[model samples]
Target: MAKPRIFEKPMGVRDFLPEFVSKKKWVEKQVEDCFRSWGYREVITPTLEYFDTVGKASAIEEEKLFKLLDGQGRTLVLRPDQTTPISRVVSTLMKEEPFPIRLCYHSNVFRAQEREAGRNAEFFQSGVELVGDHSPEADAEVVALAVEAMKACGVQNIQVAVGHIRLLNALLEHVVQEPEMIAKLKQSLGRRNLVEFRESVQSLNGSDKKQMVLSLLTMKGGQERLDQLAKMDGGKQVAEEVTHLKAMWHALEDWGVASRVVLDLSLVGSLDYYTGVYFEGYGSEGYYLLSGGRYDRLLEQFDRPASARGFALKTDRLVMASTQGPDHPERVALVYSRNMRYEAFQIANRMRRQGKAVSLFVKESDRSFDSLAGYDRVEEVIGDGNL
Candidate 1:
């Protein structure tokens, strides 16, 4: 006899049983309601796109992109992020539709991750993009929308920390003389490694400029410190950026979301594409739940020169941060014969209409009790003795 063969699921992947499916549906509905409440219309885009298009503003460190060749022998890959595809759609397909397009989406993203991260290769994301407007109000709108989404999840302890790329860029453009030094500084900032950033700055010939850059890194958190940093020498342009940030801060407060907002100048987004204001929502437990920012130049590559802004909430992280006891209450299960399947389903439907969780399973044998016993909070099991 041939040896028996065994098949196993791949690592970092798991099946979603019925209970998990119900939880996922509840979470998705909450996100959808929050987005629609803000007048954001739902939109869908293909999960795969030309590799060149998706690669434009990619910040994925591990390039574990699932790349393949299309029928035309052109490179195509699964989309690692949604913003770029949506930008392409707005620029090419939705051009002449409307200004400041308010669009929302919920979909899966694939990423190649190292084992230590313990994250899935495929995960879900829900976010909204507000394009065609560049104003403090628009920035605040996106941030507020994220806050509302979190609240809709029954999550209360989240803070939105905001920053601006222009603030850092203004300082860099004036301080760094050599192109190589600027690149090194950008990498350091992206990693949030202040020590490396200081060392790289010191390697430069000028002390005054290096010191200024180092000091800027230290001047973080809240508006007062930002104002003080603005007064430093060679910091006038940075000061103007501060003014812009202050305006955005005020707008967030005016929208009544200031209590949930924080100013973290030291905060650096992992992605390099953000060109202006950047913000991330963090759970009270210190987990990053959502992130987004402005990237006006991103769409320029597609010949669409328009102001664009958006943010994405990690569905896995969101679910982890907001999980609670079962969302639905315990209910009765009705077991019946194959001949009574339709009648049992009708009875289950009526109970469901009364807002109950009713499970109708055919009794396979006397062991059905053992199987049903595995389900926690099973209030009662109703069945005929047909078995």
Candidate 2:
């Protein structure tokens, strides 16, 4: 194999120059402020975690994990997602803390890409986890916070699609008795392949049962869908789940975010997790901005049984779509003749105290002006007086 070029970088990673960093940071600040207002405190975890623990629990595809061996020959993985690592912290370090812990984080997660598919191997996410809450209100809180965070980021036409996994599961259990077929149907929905889901439903024997299975795809729009669910014959279990969704929706209305959220029963994006009320947030042109839901079983897997839910914002994408990037600090150039270098330092020091960014330059024989391009204003000092 040939040596890699000097400028070559690993795929699915990005380099954020100064200007780009300004925008990314701007977006972060906006969302961070929104989170802080909601009483969520930030938590951070190590970039690499034990593969057997966090890697397995992360819910990210195994093939997407970037794994390596530690010095002890133990397997480690670049954390593919933040939620699992946070769960580990809550289960271990803060296990004794009181119920309903609220934690937030801004971190970069790594996922290995087999082939470059125009997706990042590493990305930034800002999110929160609310633990030890089982009420539909908890789910609605996350959904509302997701909308507020998106709005704080200046997302246009923000819309959230909400669904209850239990409802889907109950409907499936009522229709499809075979576990294998049920898993396959859910996989199709998790992948957002409605056509595949419909095809799988058609394979079932009963026409009425097939139609009921397909309602996960068709039953969407708004509260009307919830009302329709009440009138349907989806068994007692399905009615309970539907009632839970309706309660969650009313909670969203209490938060005044109902205008921005709509029902999408087919919104199951990977049904392996989330007990109920999962949602995906979208910006202009339906760009996926964030996602979150209830995961009452995840903590139990970590040796702590607690109801929890949260969402992670795609910070990089938010930066790209942000309406305005914060402006860089105004830069001042303090150029000085060789003999008056001492005077230049004093002036630069004063400006620094005044919250100005100062760049000091000494006049040489050539007097080249190339470096002055980035300065907003310039001042000069000759041997005797200012020039």
Candidate 3:
């Protein structure tokens, strides 16, 4: 490789400035507090895990993982997602704990991203995981919390679309006998490629079943839409899944987040581990803010039999959408002569104790008050005890 310039950083990574970081932290705190209010405690996990464990089990693609070898030559991976590592903790460390554990986290996850405009190799994510609950109520709870979290971040115009994977899977499996072909069509849906999906449908010999499946993306709305779908030819095949979604909708209604939600059968989740109801939240201008779904089979991979559901907010994106950040904390600058250094320290500490951020700068002969542009207030102290 050629010698890199000093200004260059690795592809897909980012450097957040102070202003951006302030907003990011604000968003993270809002989400954490919201998670806590719902009785979900926070937990921390290692950033690196054995490649055979979380690396392979994470919802991220294998090629997108940042893999390396430790001193022992065992392959290790920077965590690409939180779900797998949290599952590992639940199965091992929290094994003795009872079911229905509610945990939340704010962590930096790394996934190898290409030279793309909108992708980040390392980013911040904040979310919660509810384990050992298979009820649609659990699904509804996560969705509702997602709404509340966004509201806490001051992200307006939020729309959360919920879907049942079984409905899509059943319809595809019924029409396309081959699993690979069905997977191909699903890949198209996961990519949100309506044209490609229609093309894939047309390639399936133009059957009535293919046409019905083709309409799944447009099969989105509220109870009336659900009712319409439940009466469709293919919807009857997924009667149980439809019933699950209906129960979830009713639960969300009780939570009062139903107005911010829309039913979209096409949401296959961003991760494959999502085996049941899945959803994604969008901010204004179609910004993908967060995603979560039920992953009942994930905990089983770690030798623990339990159901789990969770969501992760793209913290960086939320920061971008946030119009407000923590004000500069009421800065106060303390200026003093060289002989009054000790007194300046005392005064600065006093101001800090009074809940203001304080900084001390020597009143040098060459210095101007203009140098303290960011300070909200400035006070100069003299050796004679004058302010």
Each candidate structure's count of clashing pairs: 0, 1, 0
| Ten residues in sequence with the least summed lDDT for candidate 3 | 229-238
Q: How accurate is candidate 1 locally (lDDT)?
A: 0.78
Name the 10 consecutive residues with the lowest summed lDDT in model 1: 378-387
Q: Model 1, stretches more than 4 Å misplaced? A: 1-7, 57-62, 114-117, 204-211, 229-236, 323-326, 336-346, 361-368, 374-387
Model 2: runs farther than 4 Å from truth?
Answer: 382-387
Q: How large an RMSD does model 3 have? A: 2.0
lDDT tens digits, residue span 1-387, model 1: 655456555545567787666766777789999899899998899988888876545555436776889999998888888888888888898988878899999999887766787878888899999999988789889999899888888665879988778777777777885777877887887888888988888887778777777876666566576567556554677777777777877887788888888776556686467888889998858878999998888888788888989999987777767745245755666777677776677777777888877777775665446567654434323444221
Return whichever of 1 and 2 wins on TM-score: 2
* Model 3 Cα lDDT, one tens digit per residue, 260-367: 999888888663778888899998878899999888888888999898999999998898876556766788888998889888887778778888988888888888
Better of 1 and 3 by lDDT: 3
Clashing pairs in 3: none
Residue-pair clashes, model 3? 0
lDDT of 3 at 359: 83
Candidate 3 has a TM-score of 0.94
